[model samples]
Target: MDQFEVMSELYSDRSNWVDVRRYPSTVTCRRMLRLADFAAADPARWGSCRMAFEVPELSYRELAVARGVSHTTIMRHLAKAEVGDAGDFTARELDGECPEWLRAVSIRFEAGCTSRTYRYAVALCTFAAAQPERWRVLRLAYECPELSQEELAEVAGVSQPTVCRYLQPVRLEVDESFNDLEVIY
Candidate 1:
């Protein structure tokens, strides 16, 4: 099927609106949560925004009904949330340009941010996206969370230590950022 046809079928049923493939990685999911928290300033919309992503199997109408709002309201919240903007950032990063959104997601920790964990997730994801090898490892790890470091190493055609090495920097960065945030607070 062509892309247009696929999209049409995908959207024809509001009840079946969400497709897991749209979110390809944990990094993307984290970015969506971060964006939702930032853009949906209204607490109600913020909850809707989170539901829209977290419960990917739920349709807009389903989400709206669950939230006791109109489906259009859920749609508006997601539109304002810019959940799809992560793809654009990934595309720009792939094209060798550092996107502004990436910088904002990775660098900024504002009052609107939902949690320290999300900030660290986006920052680590941003760091992974900056390097090709690290990106592959990160993607693989997220896709197969059940896999061990040794298994990931085998999949990536490297040693277990190398897999650990690929992820160590992100771990360290998260730890450092926690300390940084603690000091600032």
Candidate 2:
């Protein structure tokens, strides 16, 4: 049997066990039924495009180039095929207290880093952040300005390169200027 026929039978059988109120409204159900029918009508277009919509990393522009269609057409098909909760699912995945390493990677992403580069940087950062003793050593480095970066790395039990990566974002100032600007004002 065709996909629409199978879908109808499946829904009919399900409605017998499920509450009518719980089932989607007839109008909404028909819309989805129409979408399925439309997709089944052109399996080549639908099947080839489904992966682009399903895969989070694939962009519509990339799919458009592959499918030889305008991005708008690809987007329209994706919108029709997408479940209402798809966006919510993605949001829920990212909506939580992110670890420091993830926050650092997110910063890099915002700075327009490539995905591969961001992934590698995140892995490195995660490795460094996982070392509890490194944080202690970083604290000591902050407290003791006389200590060299190499010396701090030795105390931290991490490589000098790792220590440099960890401390790169830190800004330290000695405030050597002693002029009283209030008098000039």
Q: Which lDDT tens digits does candidate 2 get at residues 27-140?
A: 434334333434444544454434452243668888777777888877765543332222222222256653323422311111121222222222322333344354455566
**Predicted structure with the largest lDDT when compared to the true one:** 1
lDDT of 2 at 157: 81
Candidate 1 segments exceeding 4 Å error: 1-40, 81-116, 119-185
Question: What tens digits encode model 1's per-residue C-alpha lDDT throughout 53-172?
Answer: 435678888898899999778877766323334344345457778444434321222324224444443344344334546567767887799999999999988889888988764432
Per-model C-alpha RMSD: 18.6, 23.9
